[model samples]
Target chain A: MDKVGLEKHTSKQFDADLEDVRELVLAMGGLVEQQIADAVRALITGEGALGEEVVQGDTEVNRMEVEIDEECTRILARRAPQAGDLRLIIAVAKTITDLERIGDEAEKIGRMSTHLASYDRPKSAFYQIEMLGRHVREMLRDALDAFARLDSEAALRVAQQDEDVDREYEGIVRQCITYMMEDPRTIRHMLDVLWAVKALERIGDHSTNISEYVVYFVEGKDVRHIGLEAMEKEINEGAARRRGD
Target chain B: MDKVGLEKHTSKQFDADLEDVRELVLAMGGLVEQQIADAVRALITGEGALGEEVVQGDTEVNRMEVEIDEECTRILARRAPQAGDLRLIIAVAKTITDLERIGDEAEKIGRMSTHLASYDRPKSAFYQIEMLGRHVREMLRDALDAFARLDSEAALRVAQQDEDVDREYEGIVRQCITYMMEDPRTIRHMLDVLWAVKALERIGDHSTNISEYVVYFVEGKDVRHIGLEAMEKEINEGAARRRGD
Candidate 1:
C-alpha cells in the first residue's frame, strides 16, 4: 500500500513485473501440483514408469525455483521497490520454496509409489486414497489461484478446504489400520499408503502456507497461528460470507 | 562483505540492531529446542501432565516470534540495513518461523501422547523412535549453535547427522509394521509411534533448514535443495583426506 518510490514509475513496468512474477509462480505451482497428482496416481494404478517420471519431473521444478529466485533478487536490486511490491517479491520467494518442498514431497511419494508397485500384495482400497490425492491437488490449485489474484477471500476459502483434506487423511489412516489388522499380508502396502497419505496432507499444509503468504502480501497482516475454525466462524458471521450456509 | 554505506554513524546503529536481533533469535531457538525435548520426553515417558505443559509452553514461543518480527520491522523502518545485515535479519525471521512451526509440531506430538495414554492399548516398542528423537533434538540444538556462532563447519556437521536420524526413522517404521502384523491389536499403538516418529523426522528437517540458514548467513551462499548426502560426503572427506582418499 505504501507506494513510496514506486509511484514515480509508469504503471506499465510495475504491472509487467508483477504479472511476470505471478505467472512464473503459478506455472511453478501447476507443475508441482501435477507432480503430486501423478505421483499418487502412479501409486494407485501401479504405474512404475509414471512414478519414475514424477521423480524426474522434480528437476524442472527445482530449476524453475532457482530462476524465480534470481528474478526476484534482480527485481529487488534494480527497482528497490517498497511495501506491496516488496511484499510481493518476498512472498514469491517464500512460496517458491514451499512449492519446491512440495515437489520434493511429491518425489518422495513417487518413490513410495514405485515401491508399492513392486509389492507382491496390494492394499484393496486404492480408490479412497486417490480421492484424498484429488482433494489435495484441488486445494493446491485453488490456493495458487488465490495467491495470483491476491484474493484474500479466496485464500481463506482454500484454508477452510484444508480441514476436509485433513479429515480424508484421518479416514485413510483408519482404513489402512483396518486393512492391516484383517490380514498381516497387507503390512507393506498399508505402510506405503500411510506415507502417501502423509505426503498429501503435507501438500495441503503447504497450500495453506501459500494462502497465508497471499494474505500477507495483500493485506500486510500475519494471520498465521490463528485457529482456522475460529477464522471460518468469523468469516461466516461477517459480510464476507457469500454462499455457504 | 561489501559495506557500501559504512561511513556514517547510522551504520553503527544498524549493526547494534542486528546484534540484538541475533541475540533474540538465539534465545528463541533455545526455548523452542527445550519445547521439542520436553515434548519428546512427554511422549516417551507417558507424562500426560508434562504433555499439557509442553502445549502450554508454545504460547511463549509464539510471543517470541511476534517480538522478533516486530524487531525486524523496526530495524527495517529505522536503519534500512543493507547487504549482510539485511540478509541476517531475513534469515533470522525465516528461522524463527520454522522454529515456531517445530514447536507447534512438538505440541501436536505431545497431544498425541496424551491421547495414547488415555487409550487402553499395548505400549509400542519406541526404542528406535526414542533414539531418533534424541538425534533430531541434538541436530536442532547444534544447528542453532552454528547459526549463533556462524560456524559453517558446525552447521555442516549437523546437516550430516540428519541422515542418521532419517535412517533410524526408517527402522522405527519397519519395526512398527512388524508389531502391527504380529498382533492386530497393536495397530493403534503402532500408529501412535508412527506419528511421533514422523514428528521427529520433521524436526530433523527443521534442523536442516536452520543449517541451511547458517550457510546462507555465513557464506552468503544458498546451499538449499542440494543433495544432503553429497554435501555430507564432501564435508566428511576432510581437506587432507581429499588428496589421498
Candidate 2:
C-alpha cells in the first residue's frame, strides 16, 4: 500500500488541489451513502416524507459533481499533472460522475417509495428489497472507503460484492413476478417494486464502476470492458508484483 | 457556429492529436450505431445468430473505447490542453463512456433477442418493441451524427426525441403488463419483452447523455442534472447569444 501512495508533485499548491478534490469526493460519497440509506428506509417503512427529502437532497449532489468537474478541468489546464496525478484527477472525475448517477438512481427509488407508500404493503417483497438495498449500500460504502485509502485490494473486494448484490436483485425480481402473477390487482404495485429493484441493481453497477476507477487510479490500469475474471486476475498479479518489490 | 469551433493550440501536434481522437470517436460511434441497428433487427426478425453477432462485436467497441481513452490521457498529459481543447478532451472522454454503455445495453437487448427467439414469438408485443427500437436507434444515430458535426441544435433535437422514446417505452410496458395479466402463461415471455423495453429505454438515456456532452463541448456549458426544460432553455439562449456575437 505504501508503494501505491499518492505521487508528490514538486509544487505544494498542486498537492493541495489534489487533496482538496479527494475531500470533496469523500464528502460527495458520504452524501450518496446517506441518500441510499434514506431511500431504502423510506421504501421499507413507507415513509414518503423521508423519500421526498432524499429526492430534494439530490440537487446538492448534482451541484457537487459540477464543482468537482470544474476543479478537475482547472487543475488539468493549470498544473498539467503527469502520470499518477493525472490518473487521480481522471479517476476523481469519473468517480463523481458515478456518484452523481447513483444519487439519481437513489432519487428514483425515493420517488418509487413515495408512490408505494400509498398502496397496500407488500410485506414479503419489501423484505427482499430492503435486503438488496442494504447489500448495495455496503458495497458503495466499501468502494468509497477503498478510494479514500487508495486500497486496490479493498476496491477489488468491493467489486466482487457486486455479484452478490446482482444475485439478490434477481431474486427480488423473481419474487416480484410471482407476486404479480398471484394477483392481477397487485400488478402495478409489483411493477413499482421491480423498478426500485432495478434502480438498486444499477447502483451496484455504478459502485462497481467506482471501484474500477479506484483500481485505475492506483494501478494505472484500465480494467473496464474486460470481464470480471480477467480484472480479478490482473489485480491479483499487480498485488503480487507490488509484494515482490 | 464559428464561435464554437475547435480552439487552436500553439503546438501543431496537439491539433493532430485532437483530430485523431475525433476520428476514433467517430469510428467508435459508427460501430455502435451499427450494433444498435443489428441488435434491433435481430429482435424484430428473430434472427438469433444476428443477435449473437452483435454481442460478439461488442469487444471491438470496448477495444476502441480503451484506445481512445488512452489517447485522451496521453494528450492531456503531454499537451496540457486549455479552454476549448480541455473541454473537447473531457467531452470525448465522457462521450466514449456513454457510447460504450450504449453498446452494453444493445448487447443486453441482443441477448434478450436470442432468448426470446427460442420462446414463442409474442407477435403483438414484438410490434411495439420493434417500433420503440427503431426510434431509439434513430436517436442514437442522430446523436452520433450531431457529435461528428458538433451540431448543438441537432444534439438538442436528439435530446428532445428521448421524450417520445420514453412515452413509447411506458406504453410498451403497460401493454406487456396487460398481456401478462390476461394470460399467466405469457408472463415469462412478456417479462422478456419488458426487459428488452427497459434496455431500449436505457439506450435512449445514454443517447441523451451523449447529446448533452455534445452541447457541453460546443457551448462550454454543463447541461447535465438539469431538467430537459432547463436544458432546452439554456441551449436556446446559447444559440441566441452566438447569433448576437
Top-TM-score candidate index: 2
**Candidate 2, after superposition: displacement of residue A99 in Å?**
0.9
Model 1 scores a TM of 0.87
Report DockQ per prediction, comma-separated: 0.46, 0.73
lDDT of 2 by residue, A139-239 (tens): 99999999999988888898888888888888888887787778877877778878889999999999999999999998889998786888888788888
Candidate 2, residues B60-93, lDDT tens digits: the string is 9999999999999999988888888888999999
Q: Each candidate's chain B TM-score?
A: 0.86, 0.95
On a 0 to 100 scale, what is the lDDT of residue A237 in model 2?
82
Question: Alpha carbon lDDT of residue B175, candidate 2?
Answer: 83
Model 2 chain A: worst 10 consecutive residues (lDDT sum) = A1-10
Off by over 4 Å in 2: A1-3, B1-3
DockQ of 2: 0.73
